[model samples]
Target: MPFVTVMAREAPVLVVVTWEKTVSASQTTTQKAIADEVNPGQWKVLKPRKGLQMIDFARLWQFRELLGMLALRDVKVRYKQTALGAAWAIIQPVTMMVVMSLFFGRFAKMNEQVGAVPYPIFLYAALLPWTFFASSVTASTNSMVVNSRMLTKIFFPRLIVPFAATGTPLVDYAMAFIVLLALMVWYSVSLSWQLLLLPALVALTIISAMGVGLILAAVTVRFRDFRYLVPFMIQVWFFITPVIYPNKMVPENWQWLIQLNPMCGIIEAFRASVLGTAINWSSLGMSTVVAVVGMAIGLLYFNQAQRKFADVI
Candidate 1:
């Protein structure tokens, strides 16, 4: 009989022979046979280095079904007893567009600078992505705290909680995007091939939002100050993100600085991609780099902090 035992550092093989008198092979042959039984190749090999920390990517992959269930749970629970139900998604963005168009577009006379597009549609285009980002950040930041019972009870990836929370906003974004489509039709705005860039733009938008959400979710669990800061930061963030104004008004010299703000590019990309306007390639490229860098940092920080969450939270 032969068997293999796998440890954090290595795998070793063992064998037992029933009849010692009939030992047909030397100890070397027995060891080799055991090694071959353990692994078809080299089972007796040793590694001088310490074992690596297994990230368990496959475990996360196996839990994809759980992830979907959790995301569905969030969406169902969000609008459970609300009067309008999911209509709130459409209502909120549309309402904001009207108010902003009136205040910034009419009252402030910024409408003149908004170019050929009607102010309402322009503002709606920007709001769509901003709203998604804001909602995702808020939900993700509080995900761990809200699911403490599950965190303590279940043996799943903690990151799944924040990832699931972020998913509901994506559904809201899709509903809002439909509204945007209707508005485009109402305005008689013609769609061009440029509109095809939306999927990529939307992908970038989610990555950027999730990157920020990941950082916030981890930090908020420890400091708790981030819970309050999320809304306040989003308020300031919206103003700086050119949600109500064109990046064209940002000045040529300052455009470089503005492009460095990841959302600046994301918003500009969304508007250009959906509205069939000129693509701001420089800004979009800058934003892509910024978003990717932020994601890397966020992932590293979140993974590093994940181990401490159970102890701290």
Candidate 2:
């Protein structure tokens, strides 16, 4: 605890305590010799990290209490003044599904593509992940800028800003998941053991959103134009992802492109777990790969850019 505290503060904890003599003088001398041998210096110098090592996850872990505090702060502050409060989480996605069900379901007859599954349930399943992704990214992108005052005064991991942003929205995901449960009941869709994998799917969604969010948050500090860029990027992303339609709606020849969109596999798997549809193992595999690779790149870029955030912002 003391080590982590030192790392988090970038300095030692200077405290006054009464030293009780629990052991003899010989034992104290022996322990001091061993400690000296293990760590010759009483203190280690703190320096800005270098190269790919810039991301000190160990340090971040030591500061994890801060992450949770920030995440909780975000969750509370999000709907503080809003009339609907946390209901907004359920409302946003449910409204989108209703519109899609009416417009695309009846007008477009989109339900035929995915067989007997009702369009609302179908769209709702996909919308869950998409909404989580979109909201998390938006929260993360704006988090650093919105908390500029904290950024200048405090020195927690800059990545924590995005990390916390990504976490807070999962609360919305959980609230909206109740609607998914209701949809399952209406459609008579049965649950499966694969439902246990929901946490993994959630994790994949987090990684994908946090990765993109980290890159955007860090870059937006340098180039404010990215603020405009993110919304358009996600809007285009929405149409391209299989949110309103099933993956088979895309041509087989172009299916390769669907795998490139990390959300494709996750959304499909989510629907499958809920609706008892067939799981596309290949697509899920590719999505996992994309999420992992993308996360690495995002963290690398974020760490590389983080050093200048306090000055730039």
Candidate 3:
């Protein structure tokens, strides 16, 4: 019989393995052989990250499968056992279009601002993106608290939970977009080359939602009151975002201030793209800058706060 001692070092930590051989004399193995068996691959040393580490994109990419699975789970759970199921997606924007058309277009005469475009179509186009953004933000804001059990039990990117929360709303967005196309056909709205910019606009909307959602999600872990505040914040955000009315309705002197709200330019550009109106390049550019800045800030703050999440949540 022989004894073998294998040692493996991983930065600030070291592991030692002790084994007693029961093999026959002809089948003897060396300490190096035992060490090779104990550490066959590169060690994955996970130490507590210091303040505000750069986002580990490689690590996130490795967890891509988990991200997809979490996103799929969210979509399934959202409509599970529901009567209308996905139809609620179409119904919500359509219902909102009707109400806004009656009050804003017919009574308040906001339709006049849109020129040739039909009020319902104009309203619904903006509603399409706004609905998606609102739903995503609300879901992402509460995501941390909703998945507290998983956070405590597992080890994965904390950012993935909020990021996955954004996916379920995109399902609703796609369904609602069908109704927008039908409305465009009914109103004889012609598609322009600007329609090609839609994918970019959708990305901008997601970035904006993710930016705000990350901040709120991180905060909600420490302050449960944020769960209640999220809905009201979204409602107020809807009004300031130029959803029901045209952006031009806001006076030129104050338009710059409105453009500071990232959704303002996104919704306005989305409506313009669908209705074949001239796109506001300046406002859209401003919005792009603002959205990118917000996302950077959100990521920094979320990363800094995530370390305390499991403890407080």
Q: Which candidate is the best by TM-score?
A: 3
Q: What are the lDDT scores of the predictions, listed in order?
A: 0.79, 0.82, 0.83
What is the lDDT, from 0 to 100, of the residue 86 in candidate 2? Answer: 92
Better-scoring candidate (TM-score), 1 or 2: 2
| Cα lDDT tens digits for candidate 1, 1-313 | 3543333223211111212212333455678777775323222223442332334454466577888998999889889999999999899888889898999999999899987889898889899988988888899889987887776666777778888887799899999999999999999888879888888877888778778988999998888999999999999988889999988888788877878778899898888877788888888899999989987777767766776677778
lDDT string for model 3 (1-313, tens) is: 2333233222212321111112222134345466554323223344565644556554466578887898899988887899998888788888988998999999998888878778898889998999999999999999999999999999888989998998889988998899989998998998899999999999999999989999999999999999999999999988898987778778999988999999998988998899888999999999999999999989989988988888999
- Candidate 3 lDDT (Cα, 0 to 1): 0.83
- Of models 1 and 3, which has the larger TM-score? 3
Candidate 1 stretches greater than 4 Å from native: 1-54
Candidate 3 lands at a TM-score of 0.87
Clashes counted in candidate 3 amount to: 0
Local accuracy of candidate 2 as per-residue lDDT tens digits, 189-275: 888887887899999999988778889999889888988999999999998899898888899999998789899999999888878
Q: Give per-residue lDDT, candidate 3, residue 224.
A: 94
Model 2: per-residue Cα lDDT at residue 114: 74
| Backbone steric clashes in candidate 1, count | 0
